[model samples]
Structures are given as C-alpha cells and as structure tokens.
Target: MILALSFIESPIAVIVILGSILVFALYYFNKKQVILRKLSKTRRKAVASLKTNEFVKVHGKALHVVAPLVAPLSKRKCVFYTIKLEKKVSSGKSSYWKTIVDEEKMQDFFLEQNGSYVIVRPVPSPKNYKSYLVKDEKVSSGVFNDPTPEFKELLKTYNIDSEGFFGFNKTLRYEEGIIEVGEKITVAGIAKWKTLNEPIPEYAYSKIVELISDEKEKLIITDHPKALKDSRHSI
Candidate 1:
C-alpha cells in the first residue's frame, strides 16, 4: 500500500521538479543580458548613437575596446570623472610628495587666472597622469536645456536642493562614465577630446588625479568611492 501511494505522488513530484527547472532557466536568461535591461532612458540615447558612432562593449565590469582603437592600456585604463563637495573643500592640502620633501606646499589646483580658471596638478601624482578635457559639444549644450515636467516632478519627489545638488557641485559629480552596454557606439558625432596619449585597459585601477572644469564647484571624480571620501576629508 505504501509503495502504491508513493507512485501516485510521483506525478506531483515530477511537476514540482519541472517547475524548478523552468525557474532556473528563466534566471539564467535574465542574468546573461541583465545590463541591457537595467539601463533606463540613457540607454535609448546610447543605442541611437550606436547607429552612427562607435561604442565599446561594457558589461560585468568589463570593457572591451571597439574598432579603430586609439590608445589601449594593457594593464589599466583611465577615465575622466566629476565629484562634488559635500562641504566646503580647502585648496591648501598637503600631499605625500610634500611630506617627503619635509615642507608644507600650498598648491592651488584651481588656478586664479585673470577671468579664467586653470587646474594645477596635485603633488605625489604622476606628472603626466592620464586625463581628458571635454569641451562642450554643440548638441550637448541643448541636451539638458529644456527640463521636462517629469524631470521637475522627480526633483520635487526627491526633495533635493535643485540648484546646489544638481547643476554640478564638486560632489555627486561624474563618478565614472562606463560605456552603456546597450550603446555599441563610436565617436561619430562627438568632437576630438584632449586625453592621455594611451587608452586605459579594462582591468587597470584608475585614480582621478585632478578636476578641471570652467565651473568652480564642479570636479572630476574617480570610480573608487573611497578615494572621493578621502579627498573630501583630507582637503
């Protein structure tokens, strides 16, 4: 009698097994191309740009160069970043180089020029640290000009300081610009940028050495959140 009962329950067992298999299959499919799904409005622009421009493949924290690669770093890559100030940041901060020299060096990274803002280098940093200057493209200027009602509503929903937090404070700025996975794009519409002589490889650890921008409060941020925190505290 027990054996017969076990056989009768065997069908139910098979159905349960099949359900588990189906769930596992769904999970795998989603995991493979998860990035394409996760990106939001930025994806639309990246995808559309790919039609004319070239984009590198970016997924799983991996970046592979596209065709006509300019500068490829075999070990590491460098990228431009932006950071904002959570509080007032000081300019006269000592770096490791100054300590080794046994003297306090008050280096002004943001130069006080005549009607111009210049970015000086930080001490203990490589003299030729890879960085790029992004001159505003003609179209990029208008990209964020007319704020949509939805964008405004989101601002209200978050209850954030629209002026301070938004436009480009030294904080919450460009942490990094990994190629949007969906954007298999090229540099067709974009203009030439002043960057390092070589490209940084995907595996390399990069540090943002300096912040260069016409905007006073704006700065470049590195991918490492810890470094940004340290920069804020140190200065």
Candidate 2:
C-alpha cells in the first residue's frame, strides 16, 4: 500500500499521467476541426476554371446523374448515405453501446453552380482512409419499445436478429445520414477532364471534368454548416 501510494505521489508519474490525459483530450476534441481546417485550406474553384489533374474544391447543389439511392432508414432520395447500427451491452455495473454495423453508399453526382456543372466521382475508400460522413438522424429501441417493421426489415437484411434467444427485443440504435437531392454540398479532390461520348443537360462544354481521389489526396464531401462556412471564408 505504501509503495502504491508513493508511485501515485511521484511528481514524474503525475506529470506523465496528466500529459497523457491532456493529449487525449486535445485529440478527441480537435480531430474533426483539424480535418475541417485542412479542407478549408483548399481553394474553391469554378467549374469552368478547373485544370486537368489539379487539386480543387467546389461547392454547389448536388444533382443526381443517375437514379438516386434510397436511404435505408429514412427512405430519402440521395446520392450518398451512411448507416450505423449499435447494440447496448452491459458488464458488471457499467454499460456501453457497441457498434455492430457500419456501411455507406455513394454514386456519381453533378455539382451545379452558376449555370455550369461538374461530375463528382466518389472513389472507393482505401484501407488507410475513411470518408467523413455526417449522420444527423438517430433512433433507439429497447425492451420497453420494439423496433418498427421497417427497422426489423433493415436488421434482417444485415442478418442481425432483432430479438434475443428468449424472444425479448434487444436494445439497439440506428443512425443514418444522406445527401438529399438539391442539398448544397462541398467536395475536394483531384480533377481530371474527360471527353463526353454524348452531351448532357445544362452543360455546354464538349469535355467535362470529374473530381476523384488518389493515393495522395482522398476525396472529401460534407454538408456540415460549419465546414461549409469555413470553406466559403477560405474562398
């Protein structure tokens, strides 16, 4: 007991512990802001001014190039969507939510601004990179309240049983986010121009550019108001 107390009382040990906690707190609170700052540093470019293989950023209304995807939980028409499912677990005197599923889907969309448009090709995320998605909608269900029919169907599609072995509903939460049609969005990536085999509506150029991600630069897309504000300020 005396030795343990001495260890705890040691100035070096106290300083090390406090420093570690401070580092963790800084990282936990500022991680997203750091990403936002990096995004803001990329200068916004006009669709007509984009150069081949140049890194660029753009903000405009999202328009679907093809059939829009239906958000699984909300059933909203969107070009991109992310869904998360978590289960509540208890141990000893403490309980925590454990993530059971995480999935995202996206398709090519057009960013229209000032009578011009550019295609945005969302690249498949590499193992080292994660796409930042905003999940604004959330729902929870537990023993007192059962999941809705639609929720049960979603769980079934994931092959996750909504009930325990004893036929009791398990505590679960669902979160979803989507980039709906006509929503303003910002995107940053490497730009490449390609020749169109056929012309599309609302664009007069014979060649159009598409924003894509590469090994050095990962594509970033967000609808967060703060991020959007920062982006505009950067411009």
Estimate candidate 2's alpha-carbon lDDT, on a 0 to 1 scale. Answer: 0.81
Count of backbone collisions in candidate 2: 0
Give the distance in Å from residue 82's predicted Cα in candidate 2 to where it truly belongs: 1.2
Which ranges in model 1 have alpha carbons more than 4 Å from their true place? 31-235
> What is the clash count of model 1?
22
Q: What is the lDDT of candidate 1?
A: 0.26
Instruction: Give each prediction's root-mean-square deviation over alpha carbons.
Output: 23.5, 3.7
TM-score of 1: 0.20
The 10-residue segment of model 2 with minimum total lDDT is: 123-132
lDDT against the true structure, per candidate, is 0.26, 0.81
Please name the candidate that would achieve the greatest lDDT relative to the true structure.
Answer: 2
* Clashes per candidate (backbone, < 3 Å): 22, 0
Per-residue lDDT of candidate 1, residues 77-138 (tens digit): 22222111122233568322111111111122321212222123323242322222221111
State residue 13's C-alpha deviation in candidate 1, in Å. 1.4
Q: Model 2: how far is 123 from its true place, Å? A: 2.8
Superposed by TM-score, candidate 2 places the C-alpha of residue 201 at a distance from the truth, in angstroms, of: 1.6
